[model samples]
Target: MRTARVQDLLGLLHGWYPPDQAEEWDNVGLQVGEATAAVEKLMIALDPSAAAVAAASAAGARLLVTHHPLLFKPLRRLTPDDPVGGVIWTAVRDGVAIAAAHTNLDVAADGLNRWLAARLDLLEAVPLQPAVGHLVKLAVFVPTAHAESVADALFAGGAGQIGAYDQCSFRVAGTGTFRPGPGTAPFIGEAGRREQVEEVRLETIVPQRRLPRVLEKMLKAHPYEEVAYDLVPLANELPGVGLGRIGRLAEPVALAAFAARVKAALGCSSLRLVGVPERTVAKVAVCGGSGAGLIHEARRRGAEVLVTGDVKYHEARLAEDLGIALLDAGHFATERLAVEELAERFRAGAAERGWRLDVVVFEGDRDPFVVY
Candidate 1:
């Protein structure tokens, strides 16, 4: 079995949920420890609380993966005196690497919100707010013999991915004429000679964040010194990826009954519900953590009710005014579902990659709020 490093685990997590997908204000990715550090035991949790860090350390976990970032705001110092700083100090001192998926995990196609919708048995669920990525179309001209190599490099560098298919590209064969000028080290034609070479036009889509690296790999793999390529901005948003989810229940239920269902599904002791109890509900929208902002979107998407967390009193009133039911399940209740889900995914990925690492879900992490 292969030993896993912190970088290896980061790679798998980022492949599933790219950091660029995170919200602009969100802090994500590796929070502490070296990428080269070995990871024999891994722990997954919803929050990077001090207790979670302590539990992970006691359990001999070398890496701690959490949905929430350990450090959200800018810190001037790292010491045991400050709460956030203390967690950082503990992880580093205990040799435990920390990584967070954050908004990127929330917006992924198979992210937390989607998992919540599935848990509630929503059907035909789609993103209420689809994730917008900086998309670019890359067209590269490569010699026929080197087309495959160049395309492979582009794909490996995170290009040519669309929805479920990866390495997706269109290739067209053509003849290209180029003259090698003085001081030009040409791969085909000699100096002062014009040559017609069989070439292929390989075109694919790339996220702008990965464009620079992908282009670099493409250039290195191309046979010509001066690789010909065209990059164009795309206006289309990425599909099957977004922050919140909107879907339909198999059958319509009363708003009150649905609220009960939400509480049961999320294992919450109580939830605040807005709107009439007897209102019929079929369509639903859900966002995992502090999703009160999406209430308007849910109303616009024809959702009869919105299930989310951390809704202020005014937000509930706004939902009522918009003629939609709102269920405020605790933020921790809704997002905590991802802890076990992520751990299972890590376990499966490690198994497939032949890495001998144990993935554990932190059971001690829970809601900080309690009703008297």
Candidate 2:
């Protein structure tokens, strides 16, 4: 295995959480660095702050992957006085690349919200508001000899997946008739002569987000100069990828007891509860970071309580009116687990690919809000 580059690891990250899955308002993917930059070590953090940048550089890490993006809005100036500018200056000086997963990771199948729900032991959790991904059937006609190769390329480019299974494809053997036109260099048969050749129609299902890449790879692997393919849109919804999760605990626990469990599990310095202390609750909904927005959806999903961070006053009142409990676990505390989770996943990927890369989780960051 050769040295892993920034873009190489990015391929693995995007495979898990495609950038297109991010909310329209969110900016994800590479924020600051060249894609081809060599990376021997990677540091994962919750935020792309100056501290994270400095830590990565000091630790000799060439890449820094963060859950939060370094740049959100357009930059009007590039002075050191500005916070974002300072981070950029430090990163450029140290030659450390920065990339963000952001909302894409939030709404992925095995994402932050799912990890949070698992930590709390939410049994049989489903999305509070399901965000089904668009699916398409890609049918490509290839010569029988090259069908397997083309199918392999499509699978490598993020195609042929249904639920837990991958590399799924269907091939039908048939005879193809075609005639090469002028100035055309055909892989088989002579120009201006009608010919019939044995071919196989390879079909696979691809998420819309991966279609472009899948097509690119398939075209490259095809034997013909002009590949014959059909992309038919499907009405089927890709399941298990969305924001927030609604489920019940193994058994009912008092609202206050559940709150204590959350504090202990998340290691929060402090947390706020917006319901009666002794209220018995079984059904629960959980979302990491600022998920107060899911309160109504949770209620609709039959969750007796919603656990999330950054709950606004009106949202809390709405939860109250809806007869649901609210637990504000603090944004930093809720999202801090992303660093370790991403690091763990990246480590496994690197090892599987036989790359000698060090995956480090940044632990220097602290919650911005402090309690006296």
Candidate 3:
């Protein structure tokens, strides 16, 4: 197996959830370490805390993938005193790379909220706040002899992906004509002479975020003085990519019973509930980590109950006013599942793709909240 770099491992996650999918206020993607650094072991965790960084270094993890970023706002200085900076310093000193998924992971199709829904056994779960996917159709003209190689380069560079299919492309034989001008080097034909050659019009789908890299690779693989390619923007309007999720239980259960199930499912030692215990809840919505702001959106989506964390007094009152049940699962408890989920996903994805990456879930994850 070939060695993978830190950037390569990061690309696997970003393929599913690009930083562009994150909210404008968020800072996703790399926080620490060099992209060219070779990586063999990866550590997954909910936060890029000091403990997580130390654990990664101790466990000999070359990279740390976390749900939350070590640095959100830009720091004016780097020191071991600042909590965020300390993590950064430790990662740098210990030679461990650090990257975050953040809102990108939160808004991904199979993101944190969807994982939470799956754990609760929610059926037909859909994003409460849905956003469409942005894609580009890449049409490139390549010499017939180089078509396959160029297509392979594009695929390796993060192009030609259309849900469960990869290395996908459409090709048609055609003749391309070009004139080599003075002081120009052409792959074929003499200067100042018009030439026609057999070519293939290759077309494929590429996520808008990966266009630059894909184009670069395609150009490198093409046997032409000047590569001809077109980037046509697409309106895929694909579902499943967004924040929060609304779904139904197999059957309706009393509010109290549902709360108990949620508390047990998420392993929350305590919960804050709004509305009477006898209220029946069949439709439920959830947003992992500080999703009380989505209560109205969930209600609008026909959700009788909203399960999330960090509910404030005002938010609870609004839920009551809206006649929807609310369950306050702590933010840590609600979003913590992503650690193990990401570890397992990376393990499977790496194995399938020959990444030679070893993933481990951080064991030091403990919700700051303690029940008295």
Candidate 4:
């Protein structure tokens, strides 16, 4: 089996998701490593800590895929004197590659939120926010006989999608009139007399990021020299890319029982809670980290409880006043799934390339905390 290059792996990741979609300040992709390096051994961890790096080295892993970036802030220099800088130096010397998929993977369809939702057994999972940008509505006139073919081609290049449905569209049949100019060659009409043909108005939505490819595909499949089409900018919101999630439990349980179940599910030692323990809690809202900001939104949305991480003292006070049950599951606990999820993706990719990639999870990667 041939080992895959680091660049090839990066390309596969970007093909499904673009790193540019991440927050402007987020640092994703390769932190260090050779592009041409052959990757046979791999390690997955939440953070790129010294211990995690040492473990990867000991396992003979040539690549490390982490959820959080090793270098969140810009580096001043690569000198060995600096603590963080020293880690980078050691990685380069040991020939270990680093890569991260942060907010981009979090907001994508079937992304981080889906993994979280599945863990809690939330059914009918859809995007909490839809893709708003990189979207264009295409309205084109085609012959009634060929409309289906054109529509199918557009769908192949990422079009005709609204919410949960794909290949979605609206069609209306009408008479289209046009005359060919002297230099123009017409497909269905004469050069002089005005000609009318039966046409179907086919409309679908395409991503702005894929506009060029979509347009090219539409034109190639369209059977008219002058393909009449309109591109409209959409201001509609999408539930796919938004922060946090709102879902219902398999069955409503008491607030106290719900909290206990969540703690056991995440394997966390302790957390803060709001609202009466005996109240029946059904609907739940969850965000991975620092989600205290969404407390009011969750309450307004009628969620009985909001499970998140990193609640400030004042935020906890506010949550108490709101009468909404809130639980802080700790930052690392909420996001640890990201590392394991990414590892699964890498293992699948490696299998496709006929290379053996071992995705080992180090038990020592947990946060340094204890509860008495």
- Tell me the TM-score of each prediction against the true structure: 0.94, 0.87, 0.81, 0.78
Candidate 4 regions with alpha-carbon error over 4 angstroms: 11-21, 34-36, 71-74, 121-134, 140-153, 161-201, 216-229, 235-241, 349-355, 370-372
The predicted structure with the larger TM-score, 1 or 4, is 1
Q: Compared with the true structure, what per-residue lDDT tens digits does model 2 show for residues 222-327?
A: 9999889999988674588889888889999999999999999999989999999899999999889999988888888888889899999999999899998999
Residue 340, candidate 2: C-alpha displacement in angstroms: 1.5
lDDT of 1: 0.92
Alpha-carbon error at 306 in model 3, in Å? Answer: 0.9
Task: Sort every candidate by lDDT, greatest first.
Answer: 1, 2, 3, 4
Over 4 Å off, model 3 = 1-3, 137-160, 165-204, 214-235, 353-357
Single out the weakest 10-residue window by summed lDDT for candidate 2: 126-135
Number of the candidate with higher TM-score, 2 or 4 = 2
What lDDT, from 0 to 1, does candidate 2 have? Answer: 0.91
Steric collisions counted per model: 0, 0, 0, 11
Query: What is the C-alpha lDDT profile of model 3 across 137-210, one tens digit per residue?
Result: 99999889988899899999988777678888899999999998999999999899999999999999988788
Q: On residues 276-324, what C-alpha lDDT tens digit does candidate 1 reach at each position?
A: 9999999999999899999889898899998999999899889878998
Query: What is the overall TM-score of model 4 with all chains considered together?
Result: 0.78
Q: In candidate 4, what are the lDDT values of residues 1-372, reduced to their tens digit?
A: 877778877876665456756777888888889989987788888888777777888899887777777888988788877877777877888888888777777666656766776776665555443445656789999999999989988988888777679998899999999988887888887787698899999998876767788788889999898899999987666546656777888889998898888788777888767778899988888877667888888888878888888888889889889988888888877777777777788788778878766777755777566667
Highest-scoring model, lDDT = 1
Please report, in order, the local distance difference test score of every candidate based on alpha carbons: 0.92, 0.91, 0.89, 0.79
Best by TM-score: 1
Better of 3 and 4 by TM-score: 3
